[model samples]
Target: MSTERPRIVIAGGGLAGLSLSLALKQALGDAIEVAMCDPALKRDPHGDKRAYAIAASARRMLETLHIWDAVADKAQPIRDMVITDSRLQDPVRPTFLTFAGEVEEGEPFAHMVAGGDLTAALVESCRNAGVALMPTSVETFSAHPGGIDVVTNGGGITLRACLLVAADGARSRLREQAGISWISWPYRQSAIVATILHARDHEGRAVEHFLPAGPFAILPLKPETLPDGRIQHRSSIVWTERSEEVPHLLDAHTEDLLDELERRFGLQLGELSFETKPQAFPLSFGVARRFTAERLALLGDAAHVIHPIAGQGLNLGLHDAAALAEIVVEALRLGRDPGSADVLDDYERARRADITAMGLMTDGLNRLFSNDALPVRLVRDLGLGLVDRMPGLKKFFIREAAGLAGGTAPRLLRGEAL
Candidate 1:
């Protein structure tokens, strides 16, 4: 057996980068070396209050990587989801559609995981797997015929790798340096994210209330243990608002904002109190002109980003990592260069359709429901109602949401070894 191993370096150690590192390690074993760079990750190894929706398929990938077990105790399964369309002050926001999030007897289609917990688990897993975790950003890099040389801090520290994966984010400096043009447009909206302690149990139910402003999501989260060993019900709230209104909402008094949240959140979950100061994220849609360039490949937000209406942004990025890892591993087995044009082309071809379809779906849904036009409202509500009444169609959607319907699915998603 050859002792030489190809080196793969991932920039921006967020979910996508961490995932790719872990997947590559699993698939290639000692055949390849993986490294990740992102100072922000090391700065706050403990994540924030935001929560992520990991679909069933993504969960399986986590399981295969031996990550699910580390964080499963902190994960909250989403048993059911209900959708409604109404105004902020509407006396009633009747549910127009609902989904049963189960793929089998006891398996839910998705889970709500605290970003901090997930990140901590992934970081620990990466360390145990012997993957190099660099606490610095990729300042610049040059791609040559055989490999790419990356400089961490203005030529201070340099490293060469056969492949350079850009998981930097939507505004990726690596992508820009690679001359990869991406189409990006702001959505004129923003999301306020925060965690709340509620007075009652959520029963593992999630809710999305669509108002003229945007979608207000109440995502169930696992209970928290206090210093006194008391359990408190908690959930993540994603409140979307027009960009112009975000400043006022962010600066508003806590009491005033709580009142607004209550109006939309309903009294079902009982009293709500913010567990942390709310943070705002501007909305936008972006897709790179190409997924690969020379010795480089884009993963996660570096390649694409979409509205939060569907809560699939992270899930899509994880899928990218899975597919890319599979392709790279197969190429290695065949004695082919992992960063070759052919390998990257195959990865791009496999992922383009899925990415484009999701972008369009989320964009359309945001446009359809973020308005008060009576005709548009009526038509969409009717559509939701119709879908709700159709068990077959609902099942298809459930499967899709579970990440079960798609091409280019990796072995990990199929519950198999890499």
Candidate 2:
């Protein structure tokens, strides 16, 4: 073998790709050369329209990479999550289910973060780790048994390494180019998202209110400011709506949009108004049939995209980055080819079951709530109530929410940085 350290060329600069690079840097030290490719599209992250619920394990991973402290002040810990049927005749019915507990293993359930802030933090950490990030986009790639060669708009470079990763996301072109297939279907919904200045302080709580149309998620975020110079107490919104209504909703006036949003949100938040433009993303579930192929691997949205109802999408991907990094580092330490089929297979075996389970869980929840069939509704409602009544059972959920109840977790998310 050539005595050179293998080079890893990751396609996608989003959470997964950059994070993998950061994790790899921590895990392997100077034993690997890492390159991340993305368009680096210009956007004011401050004005971002997306937010994520970060599990406790995910937070520890950030800490290990030394990126958590950079954006620590921006995140709001989710002390509790209250889930309930929003259509009770009195509208004040007992929660169908409630999830609350520690942020870590013994910690709160999760942390709310603006997607842009998290991305910015990851990008900054990548720089600090000496991971070369290419601002240009990757237009194509070719994966071979020994290495993967990528052609980017910036130029063509042969990544002669043990592995290549597809962290590009649900529409992962690299996955396609590498001949990986996915079991995918549109959710037939669009999640309307925005930062809202709530009438009341969130008090570090989150809610997954099951409205008639879909789940309405209200997640807390650190206080922020609008462009007009007004301080705002912001909470993120994930209001799922029928696919057909999305465009009309987007075109609707601010007052009209808030009117629809307020009804589902109820009086709990008092009057609500948009602190930013409402953003809508088409929702879907995509699971790759395979995660490893020859010298290629997939992580984050590239591997699977579950329902946001569980708020586990990013957490799952972060774990993927962590696992793949560990596998590669171990392979290198053993003087084995990082891209060897055996090494890649181990990565696949470690991640497949969890990824598949999450996909099914999210899909099941969406199906359960999307319909109004009396029997199904009764059963699920009763199920939630039962869980709420059983504190012990509820704690199991709390652990799962924190991303600590699973297979061996990566060191970073364990509250120890990489």
In lDDT terms, which candidate is top?
A: 1
lDDT of 2 by residue, 1-418 (tens): 4588778888887786778898888777787889887776344435455778888888878887888898788888887778877562444745777666484354666888777888887777777788987777777766666676777776665455557787888888888888888898998888888888876788887888776577888888888667999767778888888879889988988888778787777778677888778878889998989998878888898889877888898889888988887787778878988887888899999899888888899899898887777787798898888888997777777887788775777666676543
lDDT of 1 by residue, 1-418 (tens): 2346789899988887898899888777787889898887656767566799999999998999989998899999999999999988789889999999798779899999988888888888888888999888899988888888988863368888889999999999999999999998999999999998899999999999999999999999999788999889999999998999988877999999898789878999889999989999999999998999999999999999999999999999998988998999888999888888999999999789999999999998999899899999999999999999999999998888888875648787877777
For residue 264, give model 1's deviation from the true position in Å. Answer: 1.2
Model 2 clash number? 11
**TM-score for candidate 2, residues paired by index:** 0.93
Question: After superposing candidate 2, which stretches have Cα over 4 Å from the reference?
Answer: 41-49, 88-94, 103-106, 225-231, 416-418
For each candidate, the alpha-carbon lDDT, in order, equals 0.89, 0.79
Q: For each candidate, give its TM-score against the true structure.
A: 0.97, 0.93
* Residue 93, candidate 1: alpha-carbon lDDT: 88
Error of 1 at 331 (Å): 0.3
Worst 10 residues of 1 by lDDT: 40-49
Count of backbone clashes, every candidate in sequence: 0, 11
How far off is residue 31 in model 2, in Å? Answer: 2.0
